[model samples]
Target: MTTRGPLLAFLLSLVVGLCLTVPAGAVQPDEVLDDPALEGRARALSAGLRCLVCQNQSIDDSDAPLAKDLRVLVRERLKAGDSDEEIIDFVVSRYGEFVLLKPRLLPQTWALWFATPLVLLVALGVILFSYRRRKALAKSPKPLTANEKRRLKRLVNED
Candidate 1:
């Protein structure tokens, strides 16, 4: 009975953990509309936005206040008859390009977009150069003359 009690408790906890409750204030009720298509569009747009409060997570995945605010903003834009691009541009203008999960391919942002690969290539070249230099340093020159070899051996042995 004692073993069964612990097992039952563990199973109950696992079931509770698996139950995904949206939580109070995670999403505002007013943001969702009667029209399923518009709600779906709002959801899709929200998924591409980075939550400022949870920098690595999309607004759709985040439960933070800022994420909720962004979600509402998307729904509001949709309700106002804004096209997807217009809504995205509005958010980008308000929050800067950092709000976008995928940055635009404009001239201003091009260097930032390419910097990571360039830095990686530079790092790889540095590593290769160091490895070659170390290998060169390890390779010994031809053996010295008999007299020189004897002198070197004596000095090394004495040390």
Candidate 2:
């Protein structure tokens, strides 16, 4: 056999080995659904779930054990014939709204959604108030007392 034949075969084997060893995010092979449509829905739901252990990463993107469990839970919910919203609401009820990447706009979440704009308005008001006060002060002059007027006359005479 030629050296080229052996070298090509070794390179191909190495590529295939590397591909097989790399884990695809948190989804395991056994967790995937046989139905492509259901599998797609599971993936979508996983992407929306915040992994409690990982905090910032979605269950679909995190490798934490909790994230894997959440991924499996999402698949199970899908298999049970739950609609996407129902599955999401079920998870939210168990984990609180923190499990959602984008939390719903509810009374409890109003402060979170409105805090920045309210703070900005307050800051802008403070800035504008201070600026107007400084401008008014600059425009008005205080009258000097009689003693200060006499001192000014003496200084002018000396000059």
Candidate 3:
């Protein structure tokens, strides 16, 4: 009964902790578009942008002031009748391509993108060839005379 009480209390606390919602105040109401479709587009654009301050998070998810400013800028661009691509281009021009979560597939970007997989394939082929060669060497019977075997066995027994 005593153990059960502590366990129940812990479980209750865990449940309460899980239910608590952390408020994200990154995007203010004024930044949102009045049109629902435009607002959705703004959100989509924001999500695609990487937060410069919080490098790992999207601008949509980051609470950094810079991220908020970027979000507001996106909304403002959308309100100014800028197309999604135009808004993206505006931001990309301001910041580098690193600002985009998914970068454009340009020639330079393709080189960076394809380099890893090509390198991995070359490494894998080398490793597999080495493994097969080692196995073949291990399996191939070594030539040994009866005299040599006898001498080897005697040496082992002496040791």
lDDT of 3 by residue, 24-92 (tens): 446777777789999899889999999999887789888899999999999888989999999999999
Off-target runs (Cα >4 Å) in candidate 3 are: 1-25, 142-159
Per-residue alpha-carbon lDDT of candidate 2 for residues 16-121, written as tens digits (9 for 90 to 100): 9998776457687888899999999998898889999878878998889888888888888888998999999999999999999988999999988999999999
Candidate 1: pairs in clash: none
By lDDT, is 1 or 2 better? Answer: 2
Taking the tens digit of each residue's C-alpha lDDT, what string does model 1 give over 113-132?
89999999999999999999
The 10-residue segment of model 3 with minimum total lDDT is: 18-27
Q: By TM-score, highest first, what's the ranking? A: 3, 2, 1
Indicate the residue-level lDDT of 6 in model 1: 93
Error of 3 at 40 (Å): 0.3
| The 10-residue segment with the lowest total lDDT in model 1 | 19-28
Error of 1 at 21 (Å): 13
Off by over 4 Å in 2: 1-24, 140-159
* C-alpha TM-scores of all predictions: 0.65, 0.69, 0.74
As a whole number from 0 to 100, the lDDT of residue 102 in candidate 3 is: 87
